[model samples]
Target chain A: QIAVANAQELLQRMTDKCFRKCIGKPGGSLDNSEQKCIAMCMDRYMDAWNTVSRAYNSRLQRERANM
Target chain B: MDPSASGMGSVDPRLRHFIEVETQKQRFQQLVHQMTELCWEKCVDKPGPKLDSRAEACLVNCVERFIDTSRFIVKRLEQTQKSKAGFSESLSD
Candidate 1:
């Protein structure tokens, strides 16, 4: 249940972000280049998310060790 | 839900632990989402064929610095509260 909710939320956020990043003007339709940009943006967004998560988890582990 | 089964004691301890761990992980993921959106703006000029090395480094540093800033704020607040408590105690005495 929680996993489903997280996935849905991630998708929603990705759509919002990718739209802003890729679409300069909301024209009649999503052009081919815009579609391509959104695709790449989604991948990079996931990469960034994982990178941040790893960095944060390592920091948490370091703090736990200190305590 | 029955009144007889109102408390968490009714739940399996293992399941409870699983929920707790998942909740912690979700919190981390949620923060990552937020920070990624924020740092994406600051670091990324354009989405390229891949996440560039510089942008990747920026995202990592952004996460670390954000955590540090939060900890610093919390510590500063605790110090302020301690000093205020002392002042209030002196006034009451």
Candidate 2:
């Protein structure tokens, strides 16, 4: 249940962001080129998310050590 | 007591532990989602074939600096409140 909810949230956010990043103008349909861009965009977004999570987690660990 | 946590009579000890761990993990994931969107604008110009080294470094730095800035602001606020309290105490005396 938790995993499903998390995936759904990620999907919703990725769709919103990738659409904005990849789709320049409203087209008749999501064309081949547009589809390609969205795929790459999703991959990069997940990369960014992991980088941030790791950085934040290390920062929290460092702060805890100081205390 | 939280209504959500009220029904604990039948909840298994292992399931309770799982719930606690999952809640913490979800919080981390949610923040990652938020920060990714926030930093994507700053770090990424366009989605490329892969996340280039430069953009990856930028995202990492952005996350660290963001947390640093948050801690700095909170410390500053506490200092301000401490000074104000001291000033008011002196006035009362």
Candidate 3:
């Protein structure tokens, strides 16, 4: 359940973000270039998420070790 | 009637622990989502073919500095609150 919720949260954020990045104007339809941009944006967003997660986990571990 | 034990008898200790762990994990995941959105704005100008090295470094630094900023604000607030409390007490006396 937690995993499902997490995925849903990621999906929502990704949709919002990619929409902002890819769509400059309210086009009648998602153009081919816009679709491509959204695909790339989704991948980059996941990469960014994993990078942030690793950084935070390491920071937590470092703090724990200090304590 | 002991209020603390009113509804505690039926829950298994292991189940409670599992829930606690799950809650903690969820909190971490939620923060990751927030920070990713924030740092994405700061680091990424445009989504490229891949996440470039420069953008990745920026994201890592953004996460670290963001945490530092949070800690600094918390500590500063505590200090100010403590001083405010002392000032109020002195004024009362």
Candidate 4:
């Protein structure tokens, strides 16, 4: 589906941006340790994303109730 | 940012559907970017083999409070604007 491709592109961009943040400079190829770092980085990034998402969702819910 | 491009049904259905999906996708990406930047500062120290539970919790709280703050500001502004309509109107003009 077109949706999947768009999602993939966004994921790719996020990976690039976050990797750069988590990894300062590229070493010769991705060494074993670096690969592990990236994997964890990806997981943590997703965790952070979900956290913010849930937070925002709840905030919206509370605000709606107030209104 | 422009909604005019997606206005009305003049394009192919498939393309229109694609546009709708892409718009949603972009919104997700934008939020993810914002959240990443925020939680990076709050949760991340030196990159490690795995993300510790403490940092993970911080990330969740960060996101929730960020949204809460945004809502709080919006509501506060609306309330203030009611009494300061002339002030905002002058700025808008």
For each prediction, how big is the interface RMSD? Answer: 1.2, 1.3, 0.5, 3.2
Rank the models by lDDT, top first: 3, 2, 1, 4
TM-score of chain B of each: 0.74, 0.66, 0.77, 0.74
iRMS of candidate 4, one decimal? 3.2
Cα lDDT tens digits for candidate 3, B3-81: 7566656889998789789989999999999999999999998989999999999999999999999999999978987
Best-fitting candidate, measured by DockQ? 3
Which is the leading candidate under TM-score? 3
Candidate 2 Cα errors over 4 Å, as ranges: B1-20, B85-93
Which tens-of-lDDT digit does each residue in A22-42 have in candidate 1?
A: 998799998999999999999
- How do these models rank on TM-score, best leading? 3, 1, 2, 4
- Deviation from truth (RMSD, Å), model 1: 5.3
Clash counts for all predictions: 0, 0, 0, 2
lDDT for model 1:
0.85
Candidate 1 chain A lowest-lDDT run of ten: A1-10
Better of 1 and 3 by DockQ: 3
Task: Report lDDT (Cα) of residue A12, candidate 3.
Answer: 99
| Candidate 2 residue-wise lDDT, A1-67, digit = tens | 8778878888899899999888999889999999999999999988887788788899889988999
With candidate 3 superimposed using the best TM-score fit, by how many Å does residue B30's alpha carbon deviate from the native? 0.9
lDDT (C-alpha, whole model) for all candidates: 0.85, 0.87, 0.93, 0.71
Which residue pairs of candidate 1 clash? Answer: none
Pairwise DockQ winner, candidates 3 and 4: 3
DockQ, 0 to 1 scale, candidate 3: 0.93
Compute DockQ for each candidate against the true complex. 0.74, 0.74, 0.93, 0.38
